[model samples]
Target: MPGSPNVLDLVHRSCTDVAAAHAEHVKIDDAAVSALAAELLQEREDVRAAVRGLPLPIKFSSLEQELTLLALYHLLDFGSGYDPLLTKTSGGRDARETLLFGLIGLHLGGTRMDHHKLKSFTMYDLYTTFNIEATQEVAVMPGVTMTKPGPLQPHAKALLTAINESGAALEEAGAKSPGELLLSLAEGLKKAGRTTAGAFVEELIDSLPGFRDSVLYDGRTLTLHRRAQNLAADLAIVYGGRDDRFAFSDVDQLAADSGATTIAVLRAKGVLQLSEELASTIDEGSELPAGPHERALRAAAVAACDRVVAAAAAQAAGSAEAAGPAAAAAGEEGEESGAAAGAGAAAAGAAAEAGKEGAGTGAGSTGPAPFRAVDVGAFLAFLTEEGRPLHGKITRHVTRDVTGY
Candidate 1:
């Protein structure tokens, strides 16, 4: 009993701390409703419960760490948009109406670790990077102008501190591996902030190779992948395991089990392309090549080029048909008119063939052509035998850490 803190005591302490922080918070007017105040207290408990559910190891990059902290700051100030305690003083919809106060608090509270104000750092960093600051005035009507005020107030600052401390706590809990830790941290962050944290964790998880054979990471965007089991299920459908090498074979079994029609459509599109690539491989002497991935991509490219040629031919045929009727009407009275028309059509065909030949010769050609192929033998004359001169520039950008940005 001497060392134990009961649940009631813990709840009272949290309420007291939040109430004190709320009192100290500076605002233009009394906008946060009593219901919202109560909801904030409830949110704290919910987030704490969510954190406890997370796995032991919690891992995250510094950028993710920063975002996690920012998310907590938002939640503490905004209450997840659903505080039921406001049944009495309720007229407005939600806490979003009081968002400016929340923003102001976060900006003023600044960094908990460094005790650096958010306004000072964000403005200073922005100015240093882009030669612009939030305070800089922009022209308005007549004499009116505006500029950002200084750092956030005490209440907002306290919320920011709480966020940073929670992140530090998660880091201290340490997990079995970087991946496990990341997942745990993500789950914890989700309790505090919701979808924002969920998405970050999902993207990181999808990037792990043990989790998925292939991952799609579009820098500054999204990632997509299929896990090992899901992949196996798909394989089971396609060829009934008759040929295990093909990815689609796995996908086919998955389609059967899941009743998904998309697998068939995708396979149909791929087969034509595969056929083209297979033909290319056969022409080069049926070895099937060493690199499956590269071969597949090349096959797709060849199929695309064929489609382009077919489309061009169709357009040419339609154009001649449209012109033929008009030409016949214009020359119905003469015999030599038919001969002249034939000559014009032959010339147009020759021109189209020449255009295709010229286009196939360009740098933009998707892959090697059917008749004429890429001349790999002339590579030394084009590329600097050692390397390109801009290699250093590219390396710097590719390896650059832009978190500071």
Candidate 2:
């Protein structure tokens, strides 16, 4: 695999190249991206808190169980395109919320995270597990009624397929569960003296079919791999300090979540400019298939986020340098001022370090950190969802029957 392309490098390069190309359907605005990065830098603290607070409140019996459930949840993470239908079916819960609800239910319902059990799950089992209705009433003739597939049926089918495929693959690989598979991959990489998040992500992509979220655009393969990268980020955040297996050396190399939500947030903030046709199509709630327009939008989002991380990093370094002399001056005043300045300097140094490669908890840093592409992506997604009233209504582009996101 020496000649094989690095997945993370391909993700960054392909996205940057495509965004720079400025496809006919979508355009990335550099100024807007810079502005957004500044704003995100201002909000970096809140973003960090949100990301650190992502560990589920529920208690699992063991770390393996927790990881298995988390992996399964991410495996079934797709279905953004079915949000509206999921909302209606799940008592107003969105796609992610609905999926989380189902995951929690599965755990509480005594469903073990076994590969064989996953492969045996039927559509009906998925419906019950997600607490959605399986069939809908269809009025065929007058008062005569017949049953048809529910709105969530297709989403359920997609989930079933992903689950079965993953289960089969895991079983074939002798992995008892997704968590076991992750552990094996991590151990294998460690034995080979490779311990980067990109390595872990590539392992997942090579092992799991669902993690291969790439598309060909203009003869260039754009390796998005949104879910795989997210799983890496999540592991780094949730288990970095708690578990040695989750520590990744090069987590800063991880890109943002390459999904429609990121694209939607960028478009709403004018960081991503869309053509009249594409804008109208999305605004009208048309299904934007996986093609040129969709690829451009996602790739632009990826590139825009990379620029944001770089800008934020530069800004943090500048601030740290500016504060150095000020802190020195303050230290001359009194011991209390000196102590405060020391603390502030330490905080700034940590933030500056976060901007560099391998500067997170995964790399053994133990202080306040700065922004990364994953944090920016999460912040944008949070803005679209929780900050909707403040940021205005933002609708994610609808792409049905796709397992990428």
Candidate 3:
């Protein structure tokens, strides 16, 4: 059975179009093509045996056969008998690193088939679908934190949308389904109606033996993801030189920083306008009493400057925390000097100098920038006291506050 029907021959016979597409699009040649064929046969067989050997608690015997049947169908689903599931839509990963990885709660087996799923796949996919049905963590911000959502979560919705879009995209490109379903039961479940949809998804969880044994996927990729050195550079490249951080946990920092910047800019602009108008009033021989607009602008400017200072100091505090005792000791000495981002060139210069000192460690691994400790609570209180009347009013004028990073 290892070579029966000869995997290469099967590729030639059943998956000519897929092979051609790979060569045409991905530029994979003879070796890549043959290697793919062998892997499919070997993995599919291994999966078949695993499912057969599984101590299925319920009447899972039929389910095992049905699941294998799905794998076999997935490979032959595409014209040329190519496995459609093998094609990866995007090279870069997203929350939980793509829908497939997110769904399974694990990355299983070798990555040879990672760019694509082996087939609609064996129990791996089934387990992923099952995992989807349970309450899973939805990444509100990448690498930072996860918010747990109930069944039918946001990630699942995103994944479903992606899949639908993919199918539509392919169809638009002049390919047809050939009436083959990604999952055999999906169509039948549809015909049976939406009421059965809940039950169908729930059934998948009960059928997953791999979950019990914890052998479903590899945990290495999901664990302990730390911030990369070039994170700031990469974010700037993708988002275009914004005062933002893209590390999974930096949404809070981005929000605070953006808020501070916004206040600063708005206040500077408003104060200039008010001061100009007031100066004009004085020159024209009018009274020096400030008008409502002038007062509001004055308050807004103060509030903005305050927020900017607080946010910058907070940024420094974070760096200090990351740098451990040395940063803390160094930061304590520098706190009285106002080491905020408002200091601009000086703070950045310090960070660069630190980089030079840390040169032997690794380029760009110069470690965290210099941080200043700021008492945010006391500063906020002073800010509110100085600009209380119009502070809240000015905040209400913000038209857009994008939270998702």
Candidate 4:
């Protein structure tokens, strides 16, 4: 609060600091991403009209599902030359978006086709399956343009696996409406296969409103992560947190969960790009090394958390200093009352002086209530690592105190 600009400036410094720190650790690999592109991928008009106009047997049961599907599509909504984490001005989508689309696709459409069935669809065939012909391309969010790549497309192959399965099953069973199919399919899939995509879709559909909400949640989450990483890069430029192990370690301790190792913590924070599973573990996964840019993003995010903690500490210290005089006066008054009861005015004056000395000593010696920046690692955890929001009010406190950018 005292120095809003200084806190905001940390965003820039954290970028440089993190980039230098993770220069040799691991970086983002351009090839790993195959779908959307950047961390926060970006669109929707004609697609919405097309989705509405389609005469599909089983449409989305709820508006939430439809919206989630649309957002997912918009993210995949990429063109040629896609790379995750890249600037919108430079080209297409970035790696994060690509992976997101990949995840959504894999989760819904799946990578494998069902040869046993006469006809099968994946998430990619969004428009065709639905009879929504004539895909329109437009500029989505963040200014990167792409086609109607969402699930509600002309072909509905890889759209929502849940909606597709419900529809397909309903078609086979001669079910009448979309809502009925969703309810029946969701209830019937309880004992479905765990490894198969169809079963996964069934489980998702079974959850209904909550499932769709989760997708929306995931969208907001990934976006926040992307933005946080951008700020992290900015901070790295100012403070070289990654360059020093000690500095990084301080961040790692605050940002990491209990019993997490150095590399594990870094990976969880997205500073080290390993397999998602391995990233949560104590050991690094044997996967493709991350690129420097991605690593720098994580480094910056962590460094930014550390800076927030330091600021909180400083603020608490300042408050304590400001309170010293009031505390001294209170002590003086108490001492004066006690001495007046037992001794003369001369003694009371001496006692008052003693109280001032004690207050000064107490103020000087008492540390700032063991300054614990409870929210220091909250945003990092929310974005990179999986954890609760920062402790108590500090969670929101950082918006004004730590993050102005």
Highest TM-score: which candidate?
2
Q: Over the stretch 84-188, how does candidate 1's per-residue lDDT look in tens digits?
A: 222112233222223333333333455232212221334344233222122335457779976643222222333334434433433445432232444454455
Give the better candidate number (1 or 4) by lDDT.
Answer: 4
Clash count for each candidate, listed in order shown: 18, 0, 7, 62
Q: Which candidate is the best by lDDT?
A: 2
Please report, in order, the local distance difference test score of every candidate based on alpha carbons: 0.28, 0.77, 0.27, 0.29
How well is each residue in 1-405 modelled by candidate 3, as lDDT tens digits?
222332112211222232222222112222322332232222322211211111123232332232332322221111110111112222333222233343223323322222133323343353353333324466777686565644334334433433344344334433233122213333344344521212222222222211110011112111000111112112222322221221112211111111222222243233212345544553354433322332232223322322333333334444334445444445556766435423544544444443332111111112332210111111222233335433433321111111111
* TM-score of candidate 4 to 2 decimals: 0.24
* Candidate 2 residue-wise lDDT, 57-151, digit = tens: 78888777888888887777887988877777787987788778888888888888789998898877877878666679999999999999876
Q: Over all chains combined, what TM-score does candidate 3 have?
A: 0.20
The window of 10 residues in a row where model 3 has the poorest summed lDDT is 220-229
The RMSD of every model to the true structure, in order and in angstroms, is 28.5, 4.5, 27.0, 21.0
The estimated TM-scores of all candidates read 0.18, 0.86, 0.20, 0.24
Encode model 4's per-residue lDDT on 143-253: one tens digit a residue. 788886432232122234434554454455554333333334433532332222223232332333212211111112111122222212222222223322111111111
Candidate 3 stretches with Cα past 4 Å from truth are 1-106, 111-130, 134-150, 153-155, 163-405
Model 2 accuracy (lDDT, Cα): 0.77
